[model samples]
Target chain A: TQLLEQSPQFLSIQEGENLTVYCNSSSVFSSLQWYRQEPGEGPVLLVTVVTGGEVKKLKRLTFQFGDARKDSSLHITAAQTGDTGLYLCAQTFYGGSQGNLIFGKGTKLSVKP
Target chain B: EAGVAQSPRYKIIEKRQSVAFWCNPISGHATLYWYQQILGQGPKLLIQFQNNGVVDDSQLPKDRFSAERLKGVDSTLKIQPAKLEDSAVYLCASRQWTSGGPGGNEQFFGPGTRLTVL
Candidate 1:
């Protein structure tokens, strides 16, 4: 079984501040995905990084895959209250045509206005 | 496109009782997944189905939990003799596997059914 660990389980920030969350694992995954979840709702897909050292941008949010494909990061610039939610990083592995997802503990971000 | 749908957004049951949750994945999606999310933790894969065939259920507590995807569309999860630890949000997701380009493996999630065992 593969496991992903995320740092700073809970974070509280002021508006316009910047923060970064990290996901690390000893086992390499074929791909990694980032998600943002709000209270009383399921998570929404933010991005997926497949290649090592790959970088993807979604507005102020920037995601980076580690050079070893065993870790990933999420950086948010000029954070706003709307950005307050749980950020989850999950590693997906497929044995064949079937896929199984492994999720980290998740980092809960609270941006105070 | 409509997202995955789950019924009974909330459920409250007593310990040692029985409860069931329903899920309807997005149309044309061949894969469906059920996850269990405990408080302050990420969701854990409970079961996975590929067109009504079981894929991986290693993490599922089969002792009392059982899930099935009938007709390769809708699915249901049932728990008998529930325990206090059974209280958690159940999430349903669907995805279609693509040959390449990240494999289109992203799982789209439903609103989730929150279960409370008192």
Candidate 2:
């Protein structure tokens, strides 16, 4: 089974602090996506990186795809209380002509005021 | 445009009970997905449908879990004889399919249905 391992399972940081979450895997993916989910709600797409070594910025968040396409990272600068949530990384796995996403366990981040 | 919609925000039932959840994707979205998200974990895809056709259901537990997307727009997921491990959030998502298969599309998610199996 292809698994995405996420680092720092739980994070509690003060507001304005910077934090980074990592997702690593042995298998390569065609594309990687990052999502943030609040309690009682489903995940919302933050950004998607398709090419190796690609980087995308959305406001205060910066997402980077690994050069080998086997890993990805999400960095938050000056995080606010609103940024506290569960962050997940997912990628499409082509298993026998079937394309479905395999997701990481996720990192739970808490940005305290 | 409206986001995906799901009914019964929360449900609590004993083990071995049966339950079903409904979902309505955003209008015109040709691709729909059902996922199960256990606490402290990311959402896992249980099934995927492309305009009323099954695309993938490799991870779904066929014995107790079943889902269908009829008419290519709305869908339902049912869990019969639920186990304690079945307690989790059931999320429904949909995406607009373009000429290029399943890549490069942003999926919109609905507020999940939280099920608690005792």
List model 1 lDDT by residue over B6-108, tens digit each. Answer: 9989999999999999999999988899999999999999998989888888888999999999799999999998999999999999987533444456788
How well does candidate 1 reproduce the true complex, by DockQ? Answer: 0.60
Indicate the docking level reached by candidate 1.
Answer: medium
Per-candidate DockQ values are 0.60, 0.57
Worst lDDT run of 10 residues, candidate 1 chain A, spans A92-101
lDDT of 2 by residue, A2-112 (tens): 789999899999999999999998988778888899888888988878889999999999999889989999999999999999999988655452446678999999999
lDDT, model 1: 0.91
| Model 2: per-residue Cα lDDT over B1-118, one tens digit each | 8899999999999999999999999999998999999988888999999999988898899999999987999999999989999999999998787324435678889999999999
lDDT of candidate 1 over A30-99, digit per residue (tens) = 8899999999999999998999999999999999999999999999999999999999998777655356
Q: Where is model 1 more than 4 Å wrong at Cα?
A: B98-103
